[model samples]
Target: SQQGEEDPQALSIQEGENATMNCSYKTSINNLQWYRQNSGRGLVHLILIRSNEREKHSGRLRVTLDTSKKSSSLLITASRAADTASYFCATDLLQGAQKLVFGQGTRLTINP
Candidate 1:
């Protein structure tokens, strides 16, 4: 499948701790994007990295991509209760017509 699959389907961590999630894809991609969705809400774009980039960071969020292995990881540092949400990874295939394939997503919970 061209869609990416996220690992550790669910994660729970204390406030101020860090949370990490992983995604693996089956086909070549032009770019990868990470998104967050609060309960009963639309998705919020977190970050995007191209196939040429190995790592990227935005605020407390860090993302790393390894094209060789068709894998990517997202790390949220010093997490807060507000960070509780479902995270999804979407990949834009290299040969597709600007389509994105999203994974099942990872459910993250932050405890105070």
Candidate 2:
């Protein structure tokens, strides 16, 4: 299983500041994906970086992958109060086929 673990179980930041988090995975994977969850709601995919790729960006979100270390980092620039949510990193494992394994997640709070 290509499961990942996230660091800094929790974080607190004010609006306009950037929030960064890291994710580490075990075993080789096909791709890595980042997601955001608002409270108890469902998760929304923020970005995806393939194993062959090093980095990717979407709006204020930036993601970097280091396959040599089996880890990845996510940075949210100029965060807002609405960005307060739980962020998760998932890895796509291809064992003959494909499946996604999610990490524990990082809980972030953006204070006004």
Question: How many clashes does each candidate structure show, in the order listed?
Answer: 0, 0
Q: Which run of 10 residues does model 1 get worst, by summed lDDT?
A: 1-10
Residue lDDT tens for model 2, 1-111: 437899889999999999999999987888999999998799999999999999999999999999999999999999999999999999987562556899999999999
Q: Give me the runs in candidate 1 sitting further than 4 Å from their true place.
A: none
Kindly report which residue stretches of model 2 are placed more than 4 angstroms away from their true locations once superposed.
none
- Name the best candidate (by lDDT): 1
Q: Could you tell me the TM-score of candidate 1? A: 0.97
The sequence of per-residue lDDT tens digits that candidate 1 reaches over residues 24-66 is 9998999999999999999999999999999999999999999
